[model samples]
Target chain A: MMEFLQQRLTDLELFGWDEYINYWFFLAMMALFAFELIVMAFKKAVTWNLIGDSITNFITLFAYRFIGGLIYILFYLTAFFWVYENFSITQLPLTWMSLLGCILLADVIYYWEHRFMHVCGLGWATHTVHHSSPHFNISVAYRFGPLDGFFPFFFHLPLIMLGFHPFMVFLAEALVQLYQTALHTQMVKKLPRPIEYIMNTPSHHRVHHATNSKYIDKNYAGIFIIWDRMFGTFAEEDEKVKFGVYPRINSVNPFTVFFHGFTKLGKQLWEAPSWSYRFQLLIRPPIWAWEQEQKRKREAAAAEAKASP
Target chain B: MNFFVSALSTILLGLVVGFALSLQKAEPPTEFEKYSSANMDFATMSEVGYAMAAFGRESTADYFELKDYQEYVQLAQNDHAKALSASDSPQVAASEAQASKAEAPTMQLAQVEHPAKPKAKPSLKDWPKSVIGIQRSTELINVEKVWQEFASNSALSDQLDSYTVSVFAIYSDFNSDYSRATISIGYDKPSMKGEQQLIPKGKIETLLKPSNYGNNALLNAWQDIDYSKAVKAVVERRDYTQNSELTSLFVIYQ
Candidate 1:
């Protein structure tokens, strides 16, 4: 009986806690608590919904990272094996050319790749899972599947080609990931105007995740919000709006998630009139499809008027 | 008015002396007390006595101006040494080298156990003069190789840079005898200097990292080892680099 209990206890997830005394986890938790306390100290109602949402989000994030991290490791191992079988990695030059180029290129590629994930057909397949949830928090950040490996290969292909060792790329990627971890919170609501102009913030992110008609397909920035503002895709987050995609993915089932955007793309492609129409169905921004569907409704109404007259 | 002020001064002086004597004759604190007054060190001990006369137990203040972490480490070692002496151990604190008495030197000595020199200090002083110092260096680790063996080990790499930038101590025995110990870690930063304490009057060109050992286990992503192994291993690696006679190999720890 004792052994069974011990096994169950051992199976309990540590949230990567088996290492240090769970400093980062405690820090996140204390931050939430401190925020709640500030609210209570002012005698404001401690919103139970926020507390529930944070817990649900944290658990979701943990589950995804735990499972997805294992698969990511497996794929990375294969890549490592492939590298080892190829050549001696020693005496490789870690030059300024590769370092600066990889950083700027990675950032630029991340902007486009992420923007495509939010908009295009094949890219939307995996990314729609992130937008499915009505709530937004850090957990929503990691609610991704094991298939994220394929994209990074393309994004970081330059690292391998430039004789930059796989390790530098790996380290750089980890630092960027560690940064993205904090970006998914409701905390730090607004940044200073300079960083707001250049960096992604909760305000800009709220607009991205907002399901409101006017707010859809906007504010896409992986690191630099300037990309969105410059490209005319930016929308200032309005408080009246709520989170999640329009006609939400409502199910908790993973299958429904995996197929949502792909199904939408397929249906639109089938009904499209021309080759360009079909191409736009797969390649255009999600809002462009919404506009096309609305245009079809207007044309049908106009044809009805002419026939009746 | 003058006569009254003189009387008041005499009474105040008496009160102060009485207060001082009470403090000196006070009994040892109870088990619940935070520390023994004598263990508080000489300078703090005097202040504690003054606090006792002035405000008693409420006035608890302590300070130590440690120039380096070695002092705390030395205190722990010295305590152990004192304990070992009580058990009739062969070693005596007096015989150890004052300069080479820290943990790193002792660790280097521990590697080679010649029973004859059980209490004798290790002669790190006579080792290679070509590559001996500490500061910083950069090394690009083969994370792919390390990650293969221990991919699940997420402590270092989950944060995500494959190569660790680090620093190490370099020592060259003879022209061909070189070794390095990784001392620090940064990101993509190589070739650091000016962290060592001692600077000779001449142009002693020691760049915490010497061009030796080519980022062996010292700067390797697997930053695991005691100071002794690090010192000795770097020295062994340095020996090969000194063959160039002009340039020595170095390693960085991340």
Candidate 2:
């Protein structure tokens, strides 16, 4: 059975696994959309507004797949190959053990990368596009910035430099991503106890997408739920999850979804009184800017009151 | 050929779905639409703190007291739920405003008192005396030439091109003072000639060790040196080029 699986994997690898997966991915997406329509008919589970969201999300995914790939080729490939060749500690061969090792390591790195995106403002600017949609469904899963993966290339570079083949590392990442895409749903309420306990489930991912106070930035696992559980970042799905970015996207414009955070950052930078505040606007968590703005408003109010008195 | 066919079909399928979606009429605005826009007025400090903490950034939580922490989180959660529910009618919106007014005390407190900033001590000076010695390395023998070499080096030439070389040290817990550690590279070089404490000068001893501090090795290293000490340490490179070294020395220091 192991040999058969490995053989299939090798054949798929030779045939370009990502492309092969892409063919199936579209089919699965259509099936999911159809399923959502059925569920909505009976239960009012989705809306026409969500369809518009899904359409915009589809545009992002299309751009990310084609244009993002071109950008990666022009910028990332050469440096990545150089780093792997020069700096890698050990070269692991293609075997079951190595593949498993690569997958596990890739997931660990992904957990951190996911957490970093939530923690830092620069990352949040890129990643907030995914969370902008107020509705949570399979369609929202594809709603990420076109160039989102560029920054994460550096994040995953360590895996390649640790002697895992870049292809293996990326393959593992693709598998992880495929698993995550499955996660962006409301249909599967919660899986079985063991599955929920071990792997990232729809329930856990809902909490990640939620802008509810309890859920804002929790459950940042890629494959395993254990990373969040072990790392003190875990929150159980006790409260009802409110999906979308906090201070939600008003427009369904794909360009607005893609560049809103950047636009906000640019505005903040222009208005900022100090260089430090401007830098903080660029690098601090998303909330930091909001808090600073509140502070400035309060200060201005106090000054106005004093002047009037 | 199969891949191209499949990819093209998928793209076309997406376009079809998108066109269908665009044709569908948008639903009326939900009652909660007012609260959907990102606004600081709606968010509490505790909410912000908890949000930051939820992202594994626990340091932001330092400002909140234990009492305020629970109260703020509870209030924030309640406010969020209320905002979500207020869209039912004008009556609910009125009640939501009242409820928001009730929650304003904490928000007022947050505005009245600015939280204390984290102290900034030069990383080198604050270095745990246990950092018995410091070593500095360069790609070129001449310290001045190192900057030009880094600038020219293809690997280190990018927009985000910065690297760190640890000035390694060996310190024993048993010997608190004068535990012998060598300053490995550039001890006699022009970089080390000035009256700078850049190199470990005398018996380097400190109260803290690598294990004493938090897991962030970078933050710990940053706190180890004073601004002047760091300047002194890099005095040689400053003369040759305006650009700073990509090297960062991350030592475990309390």
Q: Which candidate is the best by lDDT?
A: 2
Per-residue lDDT of B158-227 in model 2, one digit per residue for the tens? 2221221122222212122222222222211222222222333443333233221222433345355443
What lDDT would candidate 1 get against the real structure? 0.45
| Deviation in Å, model 2, residue A60 alpha carbon | 1.5
Per-model TM-score of chain B: 0.23, 0.18
Q: Report the lDDT tens digits of candidate 1 across residue range B1-254.
A: 65345335434533443233223322332211323432334354445444443443343321211112234345435645664776543233223323233323111111211111112222223232232123332222332332232223333323333222121223212122223223322111222222232211222222223321123323442233333232222222221110110112232222
**lDDT, candidate 1, A83-154, per-residue tens:** 533642321233323333334445545655576677665566557667766766665665563344446665
Give the worst 10-residue stretch by lDDT in candidate 2 chain A. Answer: A6-15
* TM-score, cand. 2: 0.53
For A68-146, candidate 2 gives per-residue lDDT tens digits of 7786667565566577678976554443445665566667667777887887878888888888999888888888874
Q: Candidate 2: which stretches are off by over 4 Å?
A: A1-15, B1-254
